[model samples]
Target: MGDKAAGGIPHYYLYGDQEADVELDLLHIEPIRERSGPNDWRIRPHAHPDHMQVLLVKSGGGGIRMEDRQLPIPAPGILVVPAGVVHQIDFDPGTDGFAVTAALGCLRTASAGDPRLATAAGRPAVYPLAGTGLDIPAVIDTFHWLHREFIWSAPGRRTAILAQYMRILVVVLRLSIAHQDAGTATPDRDYDLLVRYRALLEEHFRSQRSLGFFAGELAVTPARLNAACKARSGKTASELLYERIVIEAKRYLVYTESTVAQVAHLTGFDDPAYFNRFFTQRVGISPGAFRKQAARSEG
Candidate 1:
C-alpha cells in the first residue's frame, strides 16, 4: 500500500493500483471484503478523479475520512463519495457491505431532469439508514441484484443493472436529503435556493463564472445570492463557483491525458497562462506539477 505523496494528495484509479475497466458511462459493483480484507481492512486516503462510490454498510462499524473531516460509519449506513473527493476508510474485521462505483458521466445521465438527484450526485455525504426514510432491506436487495448482474452477464444485463443502480441512487438521495434537512435549521426556502444554486453551478460553472449571471438566473441580486450561500454554507457565491472550477481543473489534470493548455481550455479558461496562475493560486501548485505528482504516485 503506497502512501500519499510527500506533500500532495494521492490520486487513485480505484482502491490501490488495481485497474478497473471503467467506461465513460458505466457501473461496477463488488463486495466490501473483496478489496479491504487483503489489506487488513484499511483503505488509505485516495481520490478517484473520474468515478463516484457508494458504500452500504450492512453490519459492523468503521471510520471514514473525507478530506478534513473524520466521520464514523455505523452499521446500516450509506456513504456517498462523489468524484474527486479524497476519502479513506477503516472497517472492523467483520464488516459486511457492498461498494458500487460508477462513472460520473453515468451518474449525470441517471440524475438528468432531477435537480435533487443531480445535487446529491455532486456532493459527498453519509446517511445512516436505521432512522432515515429509506427501506433498508430493499436497498440491500437492489445492491445484491446489481452485483449479480455485474459479475454474471446475461441477456439485457447491462440495462437491468443500470436500472437497479438508478433505483439505488434514488433511495440514497431521498435518505441523504432527509438526513440533511433533519439536522439543519436553515429555512426550507433558503435550502431550496441553495440546492437550485448548486444544480445550476454544476451545469454552468465551466462557461459561466460570473456571480451576477447565477444570481440573475435565480431571479435574485448578487447580494441576495451571496447572503443566502453564506447563511447556509458560510461561503460567498463566488467562492463556491471558484471551488467548483478548481475541482474540475484538478480532475482533468489528474485523470485525462490532455495537455495543460488543452486542459485549461476544456475547463473554460481562455488564456492558458491565466489558468496556470489561477490553478497555482488556489491549489498551491501549478497544473503541470500537479499532473507530474499524480503520475509519480501512480507509478
Candidate 2:
C-alpha cells in the first residue's frame, strides 16, 4: 500500500517510498528516461503528498494528466505538480528530460513573502518554455546545475542546490502568472488591490461574505472595489466573492465526506436551505447531486 496509489492513484515519495527512511526535507533529481523508459514511458496516475515536482522536457513530446484534465508536454517545456495533486504523464519513446522533486516545506520556504510564488506552488500546470518571455536557456542551465549539485555534493552544495531550485521556481512562477494574465497589464494600484482582496477573501470567505467589509478592510469604498474587480476581471466584486465561496463548496463536496449541511456551514451559510438555493442557482445542480456525479466520475 505504501507504493500503491491511494484511491487508485499511487502515492509516491519520488516514485516510491524512498523518503520513508530519509529526512522529509530534501530534493531528488534524475532523468525522465531513467524511470519512464523502463516502465514503457508512461507514469501512472499518482501523487506525492509531501513533495512538489518540476519536469523539464528538453526534447520530444508527451501528455500530462492533472486530475481529469489532459495537457500537452512539448519539447522544451516545464510541468509543475504541486503537492497532493494527482498526476500522470506519458512520454513518447526516446523523450529526453529532467525531473526535480523537492519537499513541499522547502518550496514553501522559498516561496514565502511572494504571493505569486505561493500561488504557483499551490497549483499544477504545464508551460512551454519557448516564446514565453522567459529565459529558456538559463532555465535549462539552472536545472543542469542543480542536477550536478544534487549528485556531487561538495562544500556548500546544499545551499547552492537550493538556490538553483529557488531560481527555477521564481522563473516558473513569473511565466505561469504572466500566461494567466495574458499580458493584460493592470495599473499598479488596481493590481495591488485585487491581490490583497483575493488574499483576504481566501482567509475570510468562510466567515465574512460581505463585500462592504472586504472593501472597508482594504480602505476602499464598495463602489471603487467593485469597479476595480470589473476593470481587471470583467466581474463585480460580489460575483467574485460568490464564485470563491462556490468553489470552496465544490472542493469540500468533492474531496471530503462532508454532508450538504456541513459544507454549507463551512462556507458561511447559516441556513442549509439558503446554501442549497445559492449553490443550485450558480452551479445548476444540487450539492448532493454534484457530489454524486463527481464520485461517479472518479470511480
Candidate 3:
C-alpha cells in the first residue's frame, strides 16, 4: 500500500510505506537486515523518490532485479541503485551489510564538479569485490563511521558523512573502469577474465607476444582466453591483440604527421609495406587511406 506511482510502481524509502526519517534527508545508514529481515529478506519491486541506495554487502549473497536485469550480488560487493529506478532484491537468509540511502541533492553535493562520481551514482550497478583486493574490514569500518556520524550530533557530522559517501563512490568508479578498460563491464567469470586479459594486453600489446604467451601470463590456456575475449568483447584473443595494434597504428597515423612506414615501425612492424597489408586487411583500407578519411571527417 506504500506504492506511489504515476505508473503503478511502488515508491518507498525502504520496502514499505515507512515515512522518511527527517534527519536522513542528506543520507541514512542502517544494517541491511533491520528492514529486509523483517520483510523475509526480499525487497519487492519498489523505488525511492528523489533517493538512491548503496548496498554494501559485507556478507551473504543474492540477486537484485533492477528494471529488466537481474544480477547476483555476492559477499564483498557493492550495489548502486540510482534514484527512482524500480528494483527488487532477494537475499539469502542471514545476508548482512549496511544500506546507505542518500538524497539526490546529497549526491549532487558529494559529486560537485566531478561527473564521474555523479555518473557512477546515476545508474543501477552491481560490482563484485571479492578477490579484487578490497579491504573488507576497512569498508565495514567506513560504513560504521557513516552510521555513527549519521546518528549523532557530533562536530562536522554532515561534512564527515558526505566525505565518506564520496570516498566510497570513487572507489566503485575506479573498480568499474578497471573492469571495463572502464569496460567489458559486467559481473561474471568471463568478464573478469577479459578484464585481466585487457590489463595485460595494455602492458604488452605493443610488443609481439603470441596469444599463448599472454595466456601463460594469465595462467590460462589460449582456448580459455579466446573464450573469455569472445564472450565479453566479441573478439578472439588473437583478434584482440591485433585490435590493440591496429588502434595504436591508427592513432599514430591520424594524430601525427608520421609516415605510414614510420607508424608501422612504431607499432612493431619491421616492414612498412607489410604493415600496409596488415592494416588494409583489418580496416578495409590502408593506413594512409584511413588517415585521410579521418582528416576529411574532422574537416
Candidate 4:
C-alpha cells in the first residue's frame, strides 16, 4: 500500500503478500521529492518499532546517522537500520536507491538458524554489502523478485514469493551476524546504559513512562541517563519515551481494530481524551481519523 495514514513517525508505505503473516514497508524521499528541491534528499530523524530496513545504494552518495555512529556511504553499500533506532538519512544530488524494509515477525519466522537473533530483536545492524561479489547479487535479486512478485503475481503465488523473500533475508542475517561476531568488542558504559534503558522501555512502556524509573533500574541518576541518550541520539530521555509510546499506539491503530480509548489504554494513556489531544499535537491527526484513513488505504 503506497498510501500512508499519518500518526507515529514516518509514514510507512506498506507492501504485503497473502502468504506472509506480517507486512513489509519501504520508506524513502519519494513522497516528498518535489518539495525537496534538486540538491536535497533527506529523511528526518524517525524510527520504526516493528520493521527493519535495508538501504541499497544504486548511485550517488549520502550518509545515515544512527545512535553514536555516522556512516558515510561514498559508494554503493547496503545499510541496515533496525527497528526502533532513532536515525535519519541525507542524500546527495541525483542519489538513487531503494530501501527494503521488513517486519521482524516475518523475518524471525522465516529465518531458520540463530537463537540469538530472536533475543536481539528491534536493533539494526548496518553492513557494507557491495564490495562482496558473492552475497550482494543474490540479495539484490531476491529483493527484485519480491518487488516483481508483489506487483505482478496473483494472491495464490504470494506464499511462494514471501518464502523466497525470507530466504533472501536469511542470507543477509548470516552475513550480518558473522560480521558482528568477528569484530565483537565490549561496548562502552554509555552504550551499555543506552541499551539497558531501551530494553527496559520495551518491557515496561505500558505501566512506567518515567525516566527516573529507568535510571533507577540502571543504577544511574536520571540526569546522567538523559545525558547519555542525548549524546547518543540527540533526543532527550523524555522524548525517547514519548516516541516509544507513540510507535506502539501507531501499531495498534494500524494492525488492530482497537478503539481510540482502547489504544490509549494499550499504549499507557490513562485518558482517551488526553491521548487524542496528544496524538493530534504530535502527529497532526486525531486517533480515530488516522485509523480510518489507514484502514481505507489498506483496504
- Backbone clashes in each candidate structure, one number apiece? 0, 2, 2, 1
Candidate 3 residue 198 C-alpha distance from true site, Å: 35
lDDT of 3 by residue, 1-299 (tens): 56445446666755564452212235888899998999999998776754678888988989898776788887878888876566889998999898988865577668876879877776567877766667767777788888888889888987899888887777677666745532122345664576577658867887855998999999999999888765544458887688668877877887799999899888988888889998899888888899999899878
Model 2: residue 142 alpha-carbon error in angstroms: 0.6
lDDT of 4 at 45: 56
TM-score of each: 0.60, 0.59, 0.57, 0.57
Cα lDDT over the full model 2: 0.77
For each candidate in the order shown, give its overall lDDT on alpha carbons.
0.76, 0.77, 0.75, 0.60
RMSD of each: 9.2, 14.0, 16.1, 8.4
lDDT of 1 by residue, 1-299 (tens): 32243235565555575332234465777899998888899988776655678888999878888766778887898888876566789999989999988876578767776757856665677778887766789989989988888899598987888788889889877886688642211223444566678769988999998898999999999998887665444457887788778777877887799999998999899999999999899778899998998799868
Candidate with maximal TM-score: 1
Q: Predict model 4's lDDT versus the native.
A: 0.60
For residues 219-274, write the lDDT of model 4, one tens digit per residue.
99999998876654445778767766776788799988888899999988889999
Worst 10 contiguous positions by lDDT, candidate 2: 181-190
Error of 4 at 123 (Å): 8.4
TM-score of model 3 vs. true structure: 0.57
lDDT of 2 by residue, 1-299 (tens): 34443245556777755433222346889999998999999998776755778899999888988766788887898888866566778999999989999875467557766757767755567877888788888989999999999999498997898789889889778778666742111224554576577668867988987898999999999998887665443457887688778877887898799989999999999999999999999888999999998899878
Q: Determine the backbone clash count of candidate 4.
A: 1
CA shift of 230, model 4, Å: 2.3
